[model samples]
Target: MADHCNGSSHSSESFANIPPIKFTKLFINGNFVDSVSGKTFEAIDPRTGEAITLVSKGDKEDVDLAVKAARFAFDNGPWPRLSGSERGRILMKLADLIEENIEEIASLDAINGGKLFSLCKLIDIPAASMALRYYAGAADKIHGTVLKLSKGLQGYTLREPIGVVGAIIPWNFPTIMFFMKVAPALAAGCTIVVKPAEQTPLSALYYAHLAKLAGVPDGVLNVVNGYGETAGAAISSHMDIDKVSFTGSTEVGRKIMVAAATSNLKPVSLELGGKSPLLIFDDADVDEAANIAFNGMFFNKGEICVASSRVYVQEGIYDKIVDKLVEKAKALVVGDPFDPQVNQGPQTDKKQFEKILSYIEHGKREGATLLTGGKHIGQKGYYIQPTIFADVKNYGRGD
Candidate 1:
């Protein structure tokens, strides 16, 4: 393995201004290496609407390489061979490294994923650190009980590692999702091959750098940034991968399930899309309900899969609640993500921005009343106004 210490360097000043990065590579086996096919993709900054970096356009070849690395680590490397307590120590070290570089990681996430800086620092970063710690604390605690048999034969169970795991995360919450999937898998002694969303790949790549810094062994954890059709399919279908965990759209989840069955019959855990509804009862406080409803839909510009995009307000206070929600949506600040006062940032990419706009148009054409905004904010960036549709039949299907 290459010297992991020479991977990437970040200084205090690098965090001050968003540095120009050429992210045209994949991270595997503790090194940032170019794609086998030598292809690249543009990573745009949603806040500025400019291409900030060029990331590796990974395909089947790249995914195969990463999965092989993870398989090697799981089968023969020191990682799977380490004692549970020793693995826990390394995980704790990773959590500490994340805490130490929270600023840089959060900044990269904001620039790449269009997340608010305040949200990244206050919510995502700290939450990621806490998750790592939680899994670290649980690493050595994973125990199986001994079973007593009726006959003379003695029996027991061993909670062994699940071998190699493939984790595919969405773009909305990159940093937090990375740790959410990675920490638990590591704690369970599973080597991982991660494919972050193509739009928000930088934060995951940067986290891989931190993993090396924290002394994670080569081939233990690998990240390959690419489109879902190629790299994602490779990871999902690889014969050597024992399990697959995916968090993304329901459409993509279906594809992953098919791939898993056809290729290796691997175990799959899918956290798929949902149009969650927030039902407000007549007895609920009007003001609190309005506040929660507004936040649930608009918090991540409604990009999150579990975002409460469908809200059911009881008929008793429907009009009053609509009025309050309209007022709140209008009050939201939409602009640069770096600005602390801005309440909402742009969507993570152009495709999502256009999708949100199309949904607004569908709502309008379907005769749902546009109570507030339903347009773009500025000439640049992928910003969309916080939109509200009232008079939507409580029973009507949300477009």
Candidate 2:
């Protein structure tokens, strides 16, 4: 199916004019409230390595409240009793609402998560809205399977919504992850408590507000924003939750698996980090292939879990492709995300920035040839020069 998202058209007036942070409180029971401890954490702007706004910091106590709300909604609320078409209508309204406020929502992620403004507005946020609509259309189509039996004992299997769901999403693609996890659950009539990554919580909170405005019942969707060890760990182990869906690092995925098992043996869905690779043969178009390689390895500053970090080329085109990649890297623009000419934004945060630099140093020491740019671009933000390595040893991870 073709994507119906808005086209990429941004203005200097709008990109440069970012509005102030709108939603920062924990969303529960259809209301935005402060954390139990009244603690707040700074949501940083990677553009200048500074704090953009302070968001309510949720911990175990807050997570418990959010879970309770979701459980009650599942067990006693009107959402589960509503007709599937009614639920679908509400979800469709939510998607339309997201489009109505796309500018503000897109700007929030770009400012807080260090993603390119044009890309967020044009591609990511709009795609999220479309995803919601797609699931909305499927809401009414869920059904049970007919079965055959012998001896006049005929019956059919019934399908039902899973209970309360705990959704944990990474910061790399906040908008997409939010819908990818939450939409299907909502379509099936399951309430959810989401724990968005601390680095980028503003947009999730905004979406929560929009969901409520679109007539989704209170407690059907809740968002808790905080550090992973506290709020996230609580969600992973919460006994009342019927299922858990997580996306992030592999190490954390292990912890969630353990917690889900010991607490209640609840099933889990995890999307963990991995090194996906791309191989280019000699017959492919060198220029187009190089562009694909660059994008696969470096889109969103190479922050995606499926980023094609490892690339292999046939010996015949190896040198030629490397030359083309080098030229593209040199001409690439790196600066404020709002800049139309900027091809890449800063690392999501200082920790990510420093980690990439350390990895570059390690690669150099380990005998990988530094093929192109490998230096920090600016002193203000968490920026790094786009880098590539040649003559790399076939070193698997953790070797």
Candidate 3:
């Protein structure tokens, strides 16, 4: 299907004038190219349920090409061979570039990832820049300790780059996750191939472009966009990749581990799903606890992996806490992310939107009292009411 934008343009003059997303191709060796299979996927805007842009749909072939580039860069390119100070200089340049284009980058994330534009600008983009800067400083300070020998021989550990790294990121916090993975890896002189979530690939591609502009050598950084089943699996199993880092669901993390183990026993790292719980004690201040609980659940429309989904309250103050939380949820504004006044944005994509709604349905079916919201807010876009469930009990056995 052809990907195109629909609905009225939400680009307001008051905010940053974000240019339309133009670089939708896979980024490899500092160049943007279409997938070898000529496949493309529509990146739908969660705000209006319309196509934002078309991104190259990468597969195993694409992953192979990317991994090849990263491997070449690590083994023979100047990036890994450069002295720590030189690498730090380049990383610092990249950080400067990110700060220069922070607004535009944040805008891309807001529209593409369905995050609030203001929040992305105020928190997410700046946080990314901060992360890059922090790692840039570390590039020169990472040192190996000298060993003392009892005999005549003297030896020292050498801190070296771990060849090629494959990074797979999740969609809930695209901009933040991109920097979290890319910054430290770059600072450590490692070449990497990144697979941004298909739901939000714009910012990652744009960042790659900026990296190239900031003097990062060709093949040092690459990005492939596609579903997890194909490109993600390829990265996890690639023979040349020294390590695979994944941030997503536990189920997918297990698959990555299996692929890594079965393929070549390459090391794998995972930051998986969270089932965070918020507990309120009898002596706690109900108002403060309610505020924290509200932010924990409703922030980012509860798409965050660490969203406090389960809430427990002491019986003495349970009613008061629930009442306060319900009141706060009712007051949150949900609408276009571009609107500065809108505090809650739509869910990131259709699948997540539907998944959240289904959970709400199951909550009701399971006899939990729906205290506030349990439905979509508008006809267009993927906005759900801030929902709260009370009187929930664990029905299954615990391990």
For every model shown, what is its TM-score relative to the native structure?
0.93, 0.95, 0.94
Model 1 lDDT vs. the true structure?
0.84
Taking the tens digit of each residue's C-alpha lDDT, what string does model 1 give over 1-399? 111111121111112466555344799998999999888988988876788878888888888888889998888898878888888898899889888887778788888888888789899999999999999899889988888887887788889999999999999989888988999999888999999999999989878888888888999999999999888999999999999999999999999999999988999999988889999989999999998998898887677877898988888998888999888887777766666666777799999999889989988887999878888765667777778898785455573
lDDT of 3 at 152: 80
Which of the two candidates, 1 or 3, achieves a greater TM-score against the reference? 3
Q: Give the C-alpha lDDT of model 3.
A: 0.87
In order of lDDT, best first, we have 2, 3, 1
Each model's RMSD to truth, in Å? Answer: 7.2, 5.1, 4.3
Higher-lDDT candidate of 1 and 2? 2
Scored against the true structure, residue 52 in model 1 reaches a CA lDDT of 80
Task: Please identify model 2 stretches exceeding 4 Å from their true place.
Answer: 1-15, 397-399
**TM-score winner between candidates 1 and 2:** 2
Clashes of 1: 0
lDDT per residue as tens, model 2, 58-102: 999999999999999999999988888999999999999999998
Single out the weakest 10-residue window by summed lDDT for candidate 1: 1-10
Which of 1 and 3 is the better model by lDDT? 3
